[model samples]
Target: MEQRIQSYDALFELMPEMGAQKELLGCECAQPEYCFTHYLEPGYKEEDILVEICQSVTEKKQDSGQITFKVFLKVSKAACIFYKGSYNTLHKSYAMLLQYIEENGYEICGSIRESYIEGVWNKESEQEWLTEIQIPVGTGSLTQCIC
Candidate 1:
């Protein structure tokens, strides 16, 4: 987590204007998230974690040579969860979402993205932090069963 902040600091050093709101490539809002971590997985390996710490920049100027960027498009159907609380308890939320995805018969097609909506900057406590988790799905679309 500290590393991600350090990267954000590095990004800010390269582009100070990032302090202002701007739209990111894959994000829907103009307000930038503190950081986005994508977990690329059909299933995560117990021995290793696949995580990418990154943020979206608006224009070419904000993008420096030191940074590498990628643009991801939205998927046809996504299973989303809005979580509020400390980062430590995030695993519980992930469990809920993953279970939902599995039960609904959705095959994850892209990276699982976590975008911070609010946190340390605005709220005093970690309990107030809000995040959105989006998992892209495919395989003939979702069919929710009440069984």
Candidate 2:
């Protein structure tokens, strides 16, 4: 697949609000509607993790209430895989993607992004859910994985 950098303006919320679906809906945005939860920290633990909950905005919008506007950019080369199944089973798909990256001599260079393509709003079952896992890759010779 062809690699391209993507950029979007998003609304950010912290911790508890980050996972609040209702809160995200409050912000208005345009087409190809979707939401993104960016893990700002390494660990996925709930206690003190920093996450940026974002939705694509056509034009730069002002932050209101708890929502703060921020830019989300995916730079460099990227490898993506379409995952079909429950979110609980995402780890398996992620492992497969990471393995493919390593075997192909590409190193992960940034935070992993899970884009929700189809979910509860449309699909009736978790098994029918679709998510796109996008991992940014580096072109350098460094073998270290930064993801």
Candidate 3:
């Protein structure tokens, strides 16, 4: 597994659906206490700290109470560990990614972004689900992580 750095602008598009009220919608690397509101505005690049959002969705029928939701995250530049196993094996993949980060001299600047690339409602096939574990890094920032 390898991590790649990428700049994203459309991340804000998902905020409303996720029910984020007062939180700064950018990366979690910023100090959680101080909410940076304008950092994500157009052309404000200096404050672009590494950010990630863990996203998940659920659906249910009106009669039955069996609701299902898939959870994942999206992050800036970090390594990725793809797994092909049951959902119970997620922890092992996480530990492996952490080890890789430590070995490569990178720190987790903030919280994790879990992106649910595939889910039940989105697809008829339930055999596959895609997730991304994004970890912040020291390089490649529009601005920088101050907290």
Candidate 4:
């Protein structure tokens, strides 16, 4: 998560350098979130989980060193789980979402998205932090925000 935060910071700093602008999705400020997928191998450790942080841009930009970009396609349906608390307990929300999906016959088809709605940047207390976990699933309700 810290690494993803660093990537978000780097992306904000490098956007202008790459001649690209952030495409906000109906938000007041730059979208503050770490949208990524973990690449797990049999020999990988918890600390070794590797992910590629992604950010939205107004348009595709030419690659300049580390400014490479890719379009993030949308998911047909997602199990949206909302949690308000500390990062340490964030796993509980994921566990809940997984259990819900399994019991509801929802298949995990794509990468999961972690959106930091409220965090240390805006909130003072860790207990006030808000996170939304979107797990791509097959046809069903468009979105389910089990807060």
Best by lDDT: 2
Q: Give the per-residue lDDT digits (tens) of candidate 1, residues 1-147.
A: 112233222422423223332333232322453466666445644434545555654533344333445665545677889999987677788899999888977677677778777776679998899989887776654442111
For each candidate, give its TM-score against the true structure. 0.64, 0.70, 0.41, 0.64
Off by over 4 Å in 2: 1-27, 43-48, 141-147
What tens-digit string does per-residue lDDT give for candidate 2 at 32-145? 876665656563452444545566756654565556667765465788899999876787988898889989888767776778778766889989989888887875555544
- lDDT agreement with native, every candidate: 0.59, 0.63, 0.41, 0.56
Model 3 C-alpha lDDT per residue in residues 11-129, reported as the tens digit of each score: 34433333332122222222222111112132213244444332322322132121112232334465666554344455677788888888887765555444445433355554575
**Which 10 residues in a row give candidate 1 its minimum summed lDDT?**
1-10
Candidate 4 overall Cα lDDT vs. reference? 0.56
Evaluated against the true structure, the overall lDDT of model 1 is 0.59
How well is each residue in 10-74 modelled by candidate 4, as lDDT tens digits? 53343333233232222122244344333223222345344444544445645544444665665
Which candidate, 2 or 4, would have the higher TM-score against the true structure?
Answer: 2
Candidate order, lDDT descending: 2, 1, 4, 3
Note the residue pairs that clash in candidate 4.
Answer: none
Off by over 4 Å in 4: 1-45, 139-147
